[model samples]
Target: MAAAPRGASAADFETAATHAIILDHRSGRVLFRKNPDEPIPTASMSKIMTVYMLLEQLKAGTLTEDDTFVVSEKAWKKGGSKMFVEVGKQVRVGDLLRGIIVQSGNDASIVVAEGLAGSEEAFAERMNEKAQELGLDNTTLRNATGWPDPEHRMSVRDLARLASLTISNFPDYYGLYAEKKFTYHDIEQSNRNPVLYSFDGADGLKTGHTEEAGYGLVAAAERDGQRLIFVLAGMESARERATESVRFMQWAFRTFRNFKLFADGEEVETAEVWLGEKVRVPLVTAEPLALTLSPDMREQMRVEVVYDGPIPAPVKAGEPLAELVVTIPGVETVRQPLLAGSDVARLGPMGRIAAAVGHMIWSAE
Candidate 1:
């Protein structure tokens, strides 16, 4: 986008008790934030961390959908958004997922915690470690279940990051978030995540609530092939969260668009080369890359490419030789590899001498 889009404020959510934020989940661009770093209890939205952690076990083959879990009295007894699992029953990973995602079951969350980390407290400790690794600077882990604890807090930006990582890192498990309803032990419980049926292209993420936390939602949506994720961490009611989420998604799609700097191997891009006949081979990116920009960005966008000049006779095709850069202020420059399009056979002694002379002559120009 050449121009900036309309902006919202965390301050605008007057009823919100904590910071509010909206971000482009795809682009990792912050659309709006109010006290964005102020950490507040995320309610069940903290389960986003739980989901990600469990997926690790699944990927490592330590857990499987068919794996049976013996429901403990503790799991059966958890309060808030439950799949109503019965005690002394066997719950498989697939069904437990329904309880966790669809129902936001505190029990399921705890069970997964224990199953993976041997204790809910240990899993909560891991959650704290992960928070540090993800750079959730303002987030604090209080428990595996996002009960209304005073210390269990996260920022709106942090929540958005958690949601984004979940989708990006786990495509297969991401589908579970879209399931609208789940049955546990013969009881049907629907997902609390409202975005799925309320709006088009809305899927994924989690919702949270508490008397103190108010209503918070992390929702994602896609439109016109562009995906957007929204985080509203402290709304007074569910209505505002849903409304704000939809509005933010629309704003992101219409206000920002992508610009391409150059096609891959268009020439003159800088890159690193190893063990080539030439000291520093020219480079090109294997593929073209683009950037999402504001409308005003076009005025400042700069593209620079640097590569080894007309390679020696010994140059070989497909060698990394250079790099192409698309620079946008306030964003990392895009670098793509540049490669030799064709091979140059090794030069004889006379050929090398002649080539050196030719190089000198070309340099004179």
Candidate 2:
């Protein structure tokens, strides 16, 4: 392992938000976390789940972008941010999505809920079911609009996981979050997520604010081929939320990186074989191996193969034979399975006798 750098270790990093988390999108590695699992009022951030439900329908072919839903008086009368949709008027699903994502419209969420599940209460039930299905154990949805309610809560980690699911499962629709503004009924509203405007490479996600939840954001960005998903909640103000989101995201990108150690099926080492037609069997990784670590840690990184013996008569190709162990300072050691690259047939009876005699003679030297 290399000497620890002097400036700032990942352990020393901190954030002001009451609940926060950062995750490596590709590997699902948690880069940073603070009170990540405690469910708290999520405000409009819960709308991410609302949008997710809509996206699922779209992906399943049950709904289309051209689909329209009537905006009920209930939706029109609901308070808070809105898409300024007219009551009793039919609105397109595409526009409603824009309304909810870019405008953070509580009304748009209600419209989606009613359009899909007939009522907000039913839609919330579906959301809870889906939450469990998706392994968001700490999330609970009370309403489609994420309207202030004591029961509407989600943890920062759950929010980040939801963000990851949305981006990976609905790439086509996820881009809508990057839109700077949305216009409906001649009313224009800029996206509430400030990171899109202030941070480079930031594309999509949701932001939230309420008296109880304070201010929060679910943000993601892609630089190079790697993407990061992060959540920040309970900030004092929107300005602080914006500042801290960008700052924490920048720190995360600057501190850690994904390093590809080996490609899929690439030979890692060779293991000796006893009484086999072939003297050695090639060892390879079944999948590409990558690790997230600080750039400076590369110099101290160590990789080695571990296997029990150089024995066995017949070996099947792709059979698990050894382990690839990786060690880096300040990071947990990673272990990957190494498999036999090709089949090694057992030696013939005569060949085994000759091989044993040769081995004995070679050992005498």
Per-residue lDDT for 93-121 in model 2, tens only?
A: 99999999999999999999999999999
lDDT of 1 by residue, 245-298 (tens): 666556656665655554665545433332234444445456665555567665
Where is model 1 poorest over a 10-residue stretch in terms of lDDT?
Answer: 1-10
Model 2, C-alpha of 307: deviation from truth (Å)? 2.4
Supply the global lDDT for candidate 2: 0.87
Mark the regions of model 2 whose C-alpha exceeds 4 Å error after superposition. Answer: 1-11, 296-300, 356-365
lDDT of 1 at 114: 74
Q: What is the C-alpha lDDT of each candidate?
A: 0.73, 0.87
Error of 1 at 13 (Å): 12
For lDDT, the strongest prediction is 2
Q: Which candidate leads the pack in TM-score? A: 2
Q: Roughly what TM-score does model 1 have, to 2 decimal places? A: 0.79
In order of appearance, the predictions have TM-scores of 0.79, 0.92
What lDDT would candidate 1 get against the real structure? 0.73
